[model samples]
Target: MTYFNDFDINENIKKAIKEMGFEEPSPIQEKAIPEILSGRDLIGQAQTGTGKTAAFGIPLINQITTAPHVQTIILTPTRELAIQVSGELQKLSKYMKIRTLPIYGGQSIGHQIRALKQGVQIVIGTPGRIQDHLRRKTLRLDKVRAVVLDEADEMLDMGFIDDIENILKQVNTDRKTLLFSATMPPAIRKLSRRYMNSPVTVSINKSEVTAPSIDQVYFKVLERNKQESLCRILDSKDPELGIIFCRTKKGVAELTEALQARGYLADGLHGDLTQSQRDAVMKKFRDSSIEFLVATDVAARGIDVNDVSHVINYDIPQDPESYVHRIGRTGRAGKSGEALTLVTPREMKHLRSIEAEIKMAIPSHAVPSIEEVVEKQQQSWKNLITDQLNDDEDLSLFNALTEELLEQYEAKDIVRSLMKLNFSSAIGESDDGYNFGETGGAKGMIRFFINVGRNVNMSPKVLIEEISNAVGIPGKAVGRIDIFENFTFVEVPEDVAPFVYEALRYSRINGARVNLEPAKPRPKRENRPRPARPSR
Candidate 1:
């Protein structure tokens, strides 16, 4: 029942927040904003998507005056987070004429320097780039009144702790410091202890911190088959509005292209997009014009859209807490929503850790079949036809066309032709019913069988990586890998198979020596006839 008014934020900021349609302050924002505004150093413990950006941004903006230049700097772990935080701060400060710039790699440093020279009030940057600017003397923090270490644990995990420490040292010694992280690891605690000045510690309850409405599920899939399997599942579930989480911005773009090629209304969100472009994509998604959003975790943060039906993990998150945050996009406001995770064999331990932390075992679900997709499409078409028939308007035009066609062709024939056209167009032409061979890689490829299978928890991803690394072949050069319990079958270019065999002869994965040999065709079991004696 608590709301944003309790924070007593500036009227302009509050108005902007209201226009953004946020009524309640998330627990972390509620507890941390006031303390941050009181000129006290604070440590906020909260998870992603908890409105942490506004929590820190509101107070930071309130303290800055139009006269002071670049008086606040926020350090984030990834470039995506840097851009996202900067944009959110800009939105919250729209009425105040406060200038904020996001500085990170993959962008023109010369442009950042120009922006810095223009006397921006706040700089939000990734640690490495911030350090680069500091070393170049393009960034001057002498007048910085406050510094925020956002996602402190992520910075530590990413080995940016040293960069953060260096940046902190460069800022004004008397500056107020605020640290926010999802978890309080000892490393984060130590960093805070060294930098913060008797900071007030505010912790939102862990259960309340995570979205409880998300129903999480994981599918054990081989790495090579993941792309195909994911396409199938997407076709099966057909979420109305959803986001697929990938690990990197490159991955986001790659997946977005792949999804769009498959005829899905999907778009990528990442640090690479300009502010206007990102705004356009988010607007389309929120308005239901875009069905799927492919994004990295950092880029997806601070997204507060409702009615997302699903959140999918295209790759397993590196940490358990990230799994929690990715799926939290769906199943909100007492509505049931689904979260699907694709996990490789080696990542089962990571999945178990997530289950232990969340105290829920995500049920194992079968990958949807191509036939099932066809069936769903057919049903949907039938429903559409039925809905049209129920409409009160006259159908004289359609009826006349039907009658003319019926005069030349029997009703069954016309119907069959129409059905064929509809189904063929929907499913597209099949490439000779071959699974892996359609790409022309199956011709000269020799299949190798390894003695690891379902029993040993072998997955396609691990098998492909091991084979690729051991044989010095690129991952894409290796073909299909089928994992069965106690064994796996991998395809390699026939020319490279000999080299692969020699290379992996002594390789061991998970403490078991990998046995490799030519893959044998599976034997088909013969059905036996009932004995004649039974009739007697």
Candidate 2:
């Protein structure tokens, strides 16, 4: 329970920490910060979400002067990590005027070179990009006073060991090195032995499971049945808010589409989305406008919503560390959460690896049956009716009709007919059809691609509002929304798709011209053609 003030933290850093709402140091931060400040090379073994970024960032900022040359270089495994770490460092150094830049791929190399030429004091970069800069002679490490290897093991797994070693060799040998990793595998140890000076090691909270408050379970099914299995699980659990993790961007997009077709309120997030699109998705999730968010591991890292009730692994992570991070999204702040993984028979070995890494076994869960789903749906329907009855709505108009019907028909028959109709509309189709994996929705909804998205400040709400106003369709009937960088995809009733398409053919968003067309199936990697450059 050591507070930031307990240490000799700089006043500006303390102010920033307070603004960030950090009341106390995490175990890793408390233990590693002091060692790092003492000018000692250190090895920190802690999983994600342990506040490791601040553990190194604070001391690094404190030790660095406003020198023009690069004084600290941090290497990460992914662009997301690079950006995340760089952001944290910028906040920590906000009042100190220390320049922090994140260098990674998927951005303009020219821009990065220009930034480096302007003399950034701290560079947080992926190993490949850092190597690229070093080879291009655009970056010099001659004055580097500290080097940090964030998620060292992940870099090793990604085959960046050589890049790491080469970067280390270029730095001054006497510079303090800080290595933080979730696990110290043999390769990681070898890395430490070869590069780090006699380093003090800090291990935080000794639990094998990163998320001890999560209930972990897995379901075994055919790979092709994953979508159906997910639906049954969703119907059974009905989490207030949940996250579904897919392995690839394409997987994320496909699962999101499939779920929406099944009438689930869901959306997808991945790197292909513009920042505005990502922000809009997150805002909807936080506001409960969307009940489920399907995303890839990299895309999900920025999610910080507190009430995530469940984390569903649509694909098993290839490595144990990723599994820990995925499930760790829930069960936060000591709240009880659920983690469910859908596993195919072929992926049992991968599951075993995850179990061993966490030092526990995940119990097998049966796929919820058709009867179970029907019962769950029925109960939900009853709850909805009860809620409506409790509402302050005038029912005098319905009372006369009810009385007339009661006089001619048995009350049981009348109630049964109403229940049947309610269930039919609520569940969209019969339980038998759902159990057999028949997709449900408007039955004739067609998806169309619109060449306007969040880049033009488009959101699901705004898009629906515009379409309904322009095409004279109710906003509620507007189907799933998937917005990308420069375009959008929307579903509407097939009968009216043509009408809506024609209506929006000359639409514009944010003063930009709009294009409407039927959505072509996204091409797979092998068959996809090279994209033409966007017009200026």
Residue pairs in collision within model 1: 223-461, 452-487, 453-484, 453-485, 453-486, 453-487, 454-484, 454-485, 455-485
- The 10-residue segment of model 2 with minimum total lDDT is 430-439
lDDT of 2 by residue, 102-204 (tens): 9987788999999999888999999888999999999999899999999887788778999999999999776999999977899999989988889999987
Reference-based TM-score, model 1: 0.63
The candidate scoring highest on TM-score is 1
Give the alpha carbon lDDT tens digit for every residue of 1-536 in model 1: 67877776678888888877788887788889889888999999877666788999988887888974889999987665787798889889988978999998878899999988988999999888998999999889988999999888878877898898888988999799999888889989898889889999998764564447666777755555566678777778888888899999988998899778767899999978886788789889989998999998767765766699999999888877787767766766456788899875445556777778876677777666667768878778788778987999888868878879989999989877887775553454333111332222367887777776766557777777776655445789888876755677678887556556655655677667777777655435734223223235
Q: Candidate 1 — which residues are off by over 4 angstroms?
A: 106-114, 157-159, 184-186, 218-229, 245-262, 265-309, 329-337, 343-350, 363-372, 379-536
Off by over 4 Å in 2: 117-119, 205-213, 217-226, 246-257, 265-309, 315-322, 332-336, 343-536
Give residue 535's error in model 2 in angstroms: 88
Task: Evaluate all candidate structures by whole-model CA lDDT and list the values in order.
Answer: 0.78, 0.81
- How many clashing pairs in candidate 2? 0
